[model samples]
Target: SAVISQKPSRDICQRGTSLTIQCQVDSQVTMMFWYRQQPGQSLTLIATANQGSEATYESGFVIDKFPISRPNLTFSTLTVSNMSPEDSSIYLCSVTGTGEWEQYFGPGTRLTVT
Candidate 1:
């Protein structure tokens, strides 16, 4: 199992601003993914990070709005660009190890756009 941690466990930001959240894993993993969870909603996958390659985004998510970086196997970052009130949600980082089907998730970063 990999241990995951996220920076800025919670934050309050003004509308029109952006926030970059970082996710760190103790061990190298096969795949890293970013997800968004709104109040009273299930997790929505934002993107999948592949080391040394451009992140692959899910439906309704664009690279311009949610750019992701996977510099290495154990680290990644997700930036919420031009954030608005609608962007206020909990962002999570999850990873699956080599040959493992289970995904381990980080504590998550809570963002509130005013």
Candidate 2:
């Protein structure tokens, strides 16, 4: 089992600005991913941050818009670029530990784009 932590628990950003959210795991993990949750909505996968490789983004999401990086087994980051009102949501990160079937998620970075 592992614990997850995210930086800047919440923030308010202006349109056209960008925010980089950091995610860290207590133990090494093989799968790390980024997700977005709009108000009153369920989580939507943004990308899978593969270590030593480029992230695989989900449909409706572009690499240029939501860049992600997994530097190692326990650290990853997601950057929301050129923010807009529609981008206002809670960004969360999750990780699957070795031999684990369940994934644990971070507290989430609540972003409000104005």
Candidate 3:
């Protein structure tokens, strides 16, 4: 099993600004994922962060908008390149199948854009 942590539990950002959230794991993990859960919406996969390699983003997400970095097996970061009201959502970092395909999520970084 792996334990994950995310920085800035909540934040209010101005439109056009950006925020980078950090994710850390207690144990080495092969794949770390980033997800977004908007108000009253289901979770959506943003990208898969792999150590020493580029992150693989899912559809509708581009590296330019949601850039990710995984410096090692246990740490990763996701940067929201630009801010907008539409970007106001809960961003979470997750790890899959460390022991169980079920993924575990961070408390989440709630970003509000105004």
**How does residue 88 of candidate 1 score in lDDT?**
91
* Model 1: residues with Cα > 4 Å off, grouped in runs: none
How many residue pairs clash in all the candidates, one count each?
A: 0, 0, 0
Q: In terms of TM-score, how similar is model 3 to the real structure?
A: 0.95
- lDDT of model 2 at position 67: 88
Residue-level lDDT tens digits of model 1 in 1-114: 799999989999998898999999999876899999999999999999989889998999999999898988889999999999999999999999654788889999999999
Residue 20's lDDT in candidate 3: 96
- What is the lDDT for 2 in model 1? 90
TM-score per candidate: 0.96, 0.95, 0.95
Model 1: clashing residue pairs?
A: none
Q: How high is the CA lDDT of each candidate model?
A: 0.93, 0.92, 0.91
Q: TM-score: which is higher, 1 or 3? A: 1
Residue 6, model 3: Cα distance from true site in angstroms = 0.5
Query: Per-residue lDDT for 1-93 in model 3, tens only?
Result: 577889989999999998999999888888899999999999999999989889999999999999999999888999997789999999999
TM-score, prediction 2: 0.95
Give residue 18's error in model 3 in angstroms.
Answer: 0.8
